[model samples]
Target: MVKPVNVGIVGCGAISAAYTTTIARLAGLRLTAVADLDAARARATAEANGTRALSVAELLADPDVDIVLNLTIPAAHADVALAAIAAGKDVYGEKPLATTKAEALQVLQAADTAGARLGCAPDTVLGTGVQTARWYVDNGLIGRPVAATAIMNHPGHERWHPNPDFYYTPGGGPLFDMGPYYITALITLLGPVSKVIGAASRTRSERTIVTGPRAGTTVPVTTDSHVTGILIHDSGALSTLVMSFDSAATRAPNIELHGEQATLHLPDPNHFDGEIHAHPVGGTWTSLPTRAGYQDAARGYGLADLTTTPPTQLPRTSAALALHVLDIMESLLTSTTTGQATALTTTCDRPPPVPLGPLEPRTE
Candidate 1:
């Protein structure tokens, strides 16, 4: 029998509930404890999830924790991850890895030196929605891929989140906050990017909070609210990307891939599953059956997947990939400032595709 891997989460913020819920459902993982800078928040999360609450230091030093799930805000991701690695625990965390490429590199280096495995989120690509789309691309159902477009647009999060100040900070802009999903999905389908040309803008200096106790209050915007980029892939595929917090809505599909033979319409990479449509050169649009990825997966499935990875293999959501993704995003932001195309200083192999199945096989 496979013994479940023990998990201790650091950071009991809005995203902690999803990780705790996911751990409860997966057979290969167990939530043993949780921690946060806020003592009360950690205690509350532990009570709700039937686990122990500890200070951030105690949780990292806990012997039972095989992997520390870093769910802290973007600015603090690297610090928490480095601390976990120093404590001799492996780590899996939410997306972007860190606020900057330099910080992400430090986390990767620390993990490498400690001989600890590292992984990061935006694992939605491992789900049926994006994976099914990858299936078509890989099987040549879409022929030689020529180009792709990915877009994520919404009015700012200030209207909904009680604390939306982070969204406007250096690490909270549209590209950093949401670009991981799109860029990671694009890399999964078209391969690593070689270069990028970017442009960005901010709609306002401050945004008023419309909901929550902070309603009617305003937060400063220190980062771009709208960002557009053109990624030149090593495979010779050109992918245009738009990530914006300024737009209220858009009619564009979340993603689309054009090939020699057909065009594929993909569901949102932020979701685990959705419909995929295809249009042949002279044919009408048609739906494709789900053909790959973990069935009914969620946020923590990547951590579960990491738990089962062999010693010689990198997890699908490996930190190397996250670092490369971070480098691309940071470079894009740099391009916006220099008004020049920037070549990526880093790249990673595409992750192994997930076979269509449950995270853990069911027994009859």
Candidate 2:
């Protein structure tokens, strides 16, 4: 049996709640400690979850900790991940693994040197919704996935997120922030990207935060606030991806895979459970069969089939999933700097996506 692992949380922020709740419910995982730059935040998070708070140093130093969930922002993701890996812990963090490809490389290096596993998110792909889509596409139910498209458009999160300034800055653009979920989900349904041709712009020089007490505070945009890209995946599938902070509205599905036979509908990127709808070429929509009661729900990181054979645990988009995403980020950033298409190493590592069984029918 795989031994149960002690888990730690490094950043106490808004998104931290989901990680903590998920960790609490899953077996083979235990929330051993929590930490933050602000001790009070850490304490509050721990208290809410019936746990203890440790300082950043103490949490990393604890021998009992096995997995450190890096809940820090895009800017702090790599640094926190590197520190955790060095301290002999497996790690998974939020996306665009680091601020730049260089920082991401350092994270991979740390994981490699320590022989501790590394990964990052948009774990949403591992959810039942995406996995079911992966199954149908790989099985030729869609008859060769020729292309994909994903779009995320919402006013900035400033009103709700207390520390929203960073999200409007360079490392926090739409592609860097919201792009990971769509990108990671697509890569899961397809495979790694080989190249990206980007054309981006800042529609607005500034955005005013609308949700919080700081609602009226204006934040400057230093990078591309609206990003559009055409990606060629190693799987021979092409994608049109869009992310923006300024769009008042967008009708694009979070993601859709267009294949020779049908189009598959996907769920939102932030959650794991939902319906996977298939629209046949000459027909209409139908729900694909899946494991009963498992819609949108998925296995956590320790469960993804990582070794290329049958996975011992249920299929999950866990830590390994995050690393695959980091590989994509490295290549996207490289293309931005080198002005040349760069291939991701993940193209070589990931096996063809395994297909999901048809959703089983339920009896009254």
State TM-scores per candidate.
Answer: 0.98, 0.86
lDDT of each: 0.93, 0.71
Best by lDDT: 1
Candidate 1's C-alpha runs over 4 A off are 361-364
Q: Which digits, one per residue and each the tens of the lDDT, describe model 1 over residues 115-214?
A: 9999999889989999999999999988999999999999989979999999999998899999999999999999999999999999899999999988
RMSD of model 2, in Å? 4.9
Residue-wise C-alpha lDDT for candidate 2, range 52-82, written one tens digit per residue: 8999999999998877888887788888988
Instruction: Name the best candidate (by TM-score).
Output: 1
By summed lDDT, the worst window of 10 consecutive residues in model 1 runs over 355-364
- Cα lDDT for residue 267, model 1? 92
Off by over 4 Å in 2: 1-3, 291-348, 351-364
Give the RMSD in angstroms, all C-alphas superposed, for model 1: 1.6
